[model samples]
Target: MLAASNRLAGAIAFGLALTLGAGLGAVARGDHVVVHRVGASAPAPTPSATPKPTPTADRSGTVSQQRVRHIAEREGFAFLRPPGRNGEVSRWDPCVPIHYVVDVEIGPPTAAADIAWAIAQVSKATGMRFVDDGTTAEQPDDRRKDVRHTKSGWRWAPVLIALVPDSVFHGKGLHADKDSLAYTDPAIYSDEAGDAEIVTAQVVVDADDITDGGHEDPGALGPTLLHEFGHLAGLDHVHRSGEIMQPDGGGVVSYGPGDLAGLHYVGRAHGCVADAALPTDSDDFPR
Candidate 1:
């Protein structure tokens, strides 16, 4: 137990991983991409069951599919469901709240506001609750973690939001590629129903991108934060010019209609189970 406590306080290895963009092919900007490779095994296919039709209604913070489809078609949307995998992008189980731990050291002043606003937006858009589990000294790691050391009082790893120097990352070469602002690597896993859900994630910012982008780019930090969290929410880059999920620069500090549309699609699954097991120790999402 003493050794485990020390281990929690020590440097946790952050393994090298292919950029999440690599999953969609090499799309991360610049040269400094740092995606943490989580589990390497594929989840066993569960017994086949009928998937219900997608929902369409605005209730308790969720938007209607009619509205989502309209927005998706008009503003454009990127359907990044895994390859050879059919249908829409996977989602979190809305039945339970997603708890996150934000490392308060996220820096350069406006960090707190940006983090708050981003999380609020995601919660509002998805109808999925996100309760902040406070700050930590933890650095991002790709491996599975002890949610919390019941005996030692070490907090479980949550969604990390760290401010890292752009010069230190692979996607931040010329200072700002526009696309180098921030990135998220969601630690995905399967729920009881054999569906994929984002159990934990990392939303790291490139500090130099804001610094190099010049004066008061701090305001722009909100969008980058929102974009990274959007990744945590299971969104991929859309070609649309106005959406927050745009591969390049986008229109607002807020999520556009299309971004919300995709969020609507990925917020919750069509089925529910009587019980669920927390998925950190598991492998890649259900296939």
Candidate 2:
């Protein structure tokens, strides 16, 4: 089920689902500028009759554990999901490398380089590593799975970053307006202990807004890409000036001091999440 709210400048929508014994669920929200919240529920998937293998930890502890230099200005940053009573906010497992793929079918010529630049900035801020899987034919899906079956075996799905036409948003049950620059949907997993981790996410940009002629121009797509990537990294919109996580992009091409601080808080400096388990095939989503 889904619920939506309207504002003078833009619209916001939310979708919620509950998945029974699997303890899996999702809460989705999106907007052009103004943010709103809504709640709804869906029937859970029936549990598989056959017992499944015990879930194992995916963190390898091989990634370098480097702490980011503390930033003096931290007031401008905020988390999309605020910290729980345990003082931990949802974030990706910093020990594992985040894999991603690009769908450039409708992207500008500079799409590849532009994405790399933005990811590089985020990587520097957070100690999280990202592996580029090059281009993929896969399109964006709001109900994307946490893992995919490959010839080698089952592994976590790669983060998808795509440049699609505005019309594509009209389908896929997405709530963004045709004029919205971009939208990001992150799949998260939480345990009974209240610890949560973002397993995968999707970043979709409006290809129509970024054409070949102005692809290289400043602010054409850089700020928007960074803003959405920040969302993928769990940073939420902040009204403070000069921050890339601003609701309207804030006309800034790079991350501000607060953005850096927030990224570090969710970054590798926090140490590995050894007990974080990757969801199995039977585990239903928004987990």
Candidate 3:
């Protein structure tokens, strides 16, 4: 029994010695312990990534056709529309072409005040003298009171600058059967009219506001007038945005250089007698 107790005491002593040795080792390694934090915000958790905004179509502002026309005329391009035509056009006429006699009836013409302002802008930019043949700032309803009839056709002057309020765009007002279209000579450009007799009348369709890129009118004011003038100048819409003859008017302001070049070519070279019979063939108008 004494021998068994001695063995147990030795074992206990050995355990105590091992424990003491471990404590000594820990003491020797003082300040060597590494502490790690693992809390929710221990290192200031990064913010979740924010989502980016999706891209959208531009729907910001509106533009005026008159402003566009002013830009064209300012750039030394004479903007003329035949009495009644659709689409837009720019031309430089050396002589009064048969088409020049036509007056494009711009619906919703501008108010008197606006008209004067537009004329002033045109005069300043174009440096061409504009003769006002009509009265000032009359309501669009009374526009017919100032109409003057001519031998070749009727002349309505003082370009309508203001658009009618809440005016919706109908199609071109010109047709063979429409009586309101008084200047309906089948010979749009013929041998009868002298070169100097062809006169262009500018008409503005007054509307409450101009349309935007999305809700554009096919026969709006500036576009309509320009288109008619192209016809008067013996050119048709080329379906090219660069050309003023383009039917679909959008964000563009004036005829590109190509259009001006074409205008010079057609106005000086192509005459009503020679080019009148050709069908309106151009692939360059606005689609």
Steric clashes per prediction? 6, 2, 34
**Compared to the true structure, candidate 2 yields what TM-score?**
0.71
For candidate 1, write residues 11-30 as lDDT tens digits.
Answer: 22111111111121211111
**Which has the higher lDDT value, candidate number 1 or candidate number 2?**
2
TM-score of each: 0.61, 0.71, 0.33
Model 2: CA > 4 A from native? 1-74, 211-219, 280-287
Each prediction's Cα RMSD? 13.0, 13.9, 39.3
lDDT of 3 by residue, 1-287 (tens): 33543443344334434432222111110011101111111233221111111112322223333443344444433333321121122322333222211122333333333334433433332333445545444432221221223443323223222233332222243121111111111111111121111223333332323332221333333433333333333333333445444433223444455445445534544333222111111111001
Indicate the worst ten consecutive residues by lDDT in candidate 3.
Answer: 27-36
| lDDT, candidate 2, at 204 | 81
Of 1 and 3, which scores higher on lDDT?
Answer: 1
For residues 127-212, could you state the per-residue lDDT of candidate 2 as single tens digits? 99999998999988665555565554445679998888778855666645433557777766666555677777888877776534
Best by TM-score: 2
What lDDT would each prediction earn against the true structure?
0.50, 0.60, 0.29
Q: Name the best candidate (by lDDT).
A: 2
